[model samples]
Target chain A: MANLILLKEVGEAMNKAAIDAFPNECCGFFFGHEVGEDRVVQEVMPVENSKEGDQRRRFSIDPKAYMDAEKHALAMDMSLLGVYHSHPSHPAIPSEHDLKQAMPWFSYIILSVEKEAVKNTTSWQLDEARKFKNETLKQL
Target chain B: MAQVIIPTPLRKFTNSQARFEAAGNTVQDVLKALSTQHQGLKTHLLDENGELRSFVRVYLGDEDINFLQKGATPIEANSIISIIPAIAGGIV
Candidate 1:
């Protein structure tokens, strides 16, 4: 898998999570094996947004939730590939705030949820210079 | 004793030390020792009341200290601790 390969089932689950949390940002984790440059996603871990206020425009993954997700990934013998989140009423693009918080090497999947419908889903990666580079997404 | 791994964002306060060993029977003790070694780490890790900063997460292995014992989680010699900042953001 030279590009980001997301299993069809996983993609649908993420879309559902995005639509279900409409008007608020939904966040989750994806994990699977990494063979060369291809990241094969096999699992999806939806995390609750722990931000205290304004869930619509902001999403925060609690460390506890992260730890739990890591435990699950470990149990499945999979590595953490990246995080997925939805932007309510917005485009499937990384925002300035997202760029500031993102780390290199991890894939960031952004879903655009508008009017309670998932319109688009895109994946991105951060380069060495800390710039967001769109990743080629293969939904299979 | 325990080994605490520092993240890149907070490395400047720890002299770029990726990992360091500190003496402590509990996570609290280890963090206290670490703060003493690097004065700048205290504020980033703990609030004025000496509690863990809201945005700072201390993990013992794969378990969060907040779910276990907060700062009082007991640890063995090989206990690995990781400090991760809460990541949150959105365009206004």
Candidate 2:
């Protein structure tokens, strides 16, 4: 299992995204590098939704965000190590849909917020066959 | 024979089949058989260099193949493999 670390900035960013997308859903990607032993967040890419109504909260990464993330990672010599999205009213964990979409190598982070208050946050890594296995998150 | 569990996004490529029996002694061989049966799926699972794509994950039963032998991970007749893609989204 790979170790995961969420920097304080990541928490703050997630919180902001959660609040910004309240009553709906907010999604974004987390870019960072492996520093000696831990993954650190260097950038956050939040994209506008193309879907209509509450369906926007279901989750999807904008194609533009992928290009931007790739550019940023190349510049920093880091990788797109993880992705983060908020559960407006749900807990921070991988839903069944999340499991189906989880990539094996990237860390998946979920931020759970209620009424603008951060409730919980967690990260997951995909197993060989792409099942999400929970990973401990250390806040830096 | 090995069982390959298809994830939803990739089901279209597999003719909407969720699982299929593939013949192989190793993960690579099984994947090769799958790709041969479902054209274009190999591109989704492997990079141009034949390396597992960073975004695709393969699991043997409950264990990740990466922790085992990667594409070379041995597979028994009844082994089950799962393919998962990375998905992300939220309200904004």
Candidate 3:
């Protein structure tokens, strides 16, 4: 499995954001560079979940927010490697909706938030079959 | 001529080229030139009805074209157009 390298502090920050969002899902971006088959995360940028109605089960980054993040990544000289989102009260697994919405070439880091606490963290990527395969998450 | 910056995900359709210079007087023209140059990119940027996909956001300079004149937004010779795909998903 491919691995994604994240700084301990960066990982902690994602966890905190997940917990903070609580009953609702939290969405964000990860700015990083690719090292061979592995991705090294340098920053975690949280964005507003623009999905209207039932935010707890869904999350969508506003078009403006996505553009802003792209510019920010460009300014920082980093690639928008992937996205991170929390699944409130659900496991850190990519749901069917995720596979349908996801594009190739970006990693997805999912945080499992259970009762205002983080439970598990998992990373995923969409395969050629449009299914998500788990990626190893390494925090250092 | 306007420079359209293609996001990383869509670069594969452009032969992995990040940015390409296209000739047009408006956002629509430039996009038309882009799709004409890279035939594989047409569907990704536009749907069957030829409308920009909901997940695909096009910006004329720093402003989203949607807030401007949309596809009819005028462009300068050196204008920069950026294509950003929305990052979204859900637990369900």
List ranges where model 3 is wrong by over 4 Å: none
Tens-digit lDDT string for candidate 2 (A9-119): 767887888787776667777777677656777677776544454643587654444545655655776666767777878888778777755654577788887876878
Candidate 2 residue runs with Cα over 4 Å from true position: B1-43, B46-92
Models, CA RMSD each: 6.0, 12.9, 2.1
Tens digits of per-residue lDDT for model 1 on A37-100?
Answer: 8889988989898878999999999876766665576677777778899999888999998987
Clashing pairs in 1: none
lDDT: worst 10-residue window of model 1 chain B: B83-92
Q: Quote the TM-score that chain A achieves in each candidate.
A: 0.95, 0.87, 0.96
| lDDT (Cα, 0-100) at B14 in candidate 3 | 90
Query: Could you report the DockQ of all the candidates, in the order they appear?
Result: 0.31, 0.17, 0.65
Candidate 1 per-residue lDDT over residues B1-92, each given as its tens digit:
68997754466688867688987789999988989899978867888998888767888997888899888899999999988766676544
User: Candidate 1 vs candidate 2: which has greater DockQ?
Assistant: 1
Q: Which pairs of residues collide in candidate 3?
A: none
- Which ten contiguous residues of candidate 2 chain A have the minimum total lDDT? A62-71
Candidate scoring better on DockQ of 1 and 3: 3
Query: Can you rank all candidates by lDDT, best first?
Result: 3, 1, 2
Best by DockQ: 3
TM-score of 2: 0.60
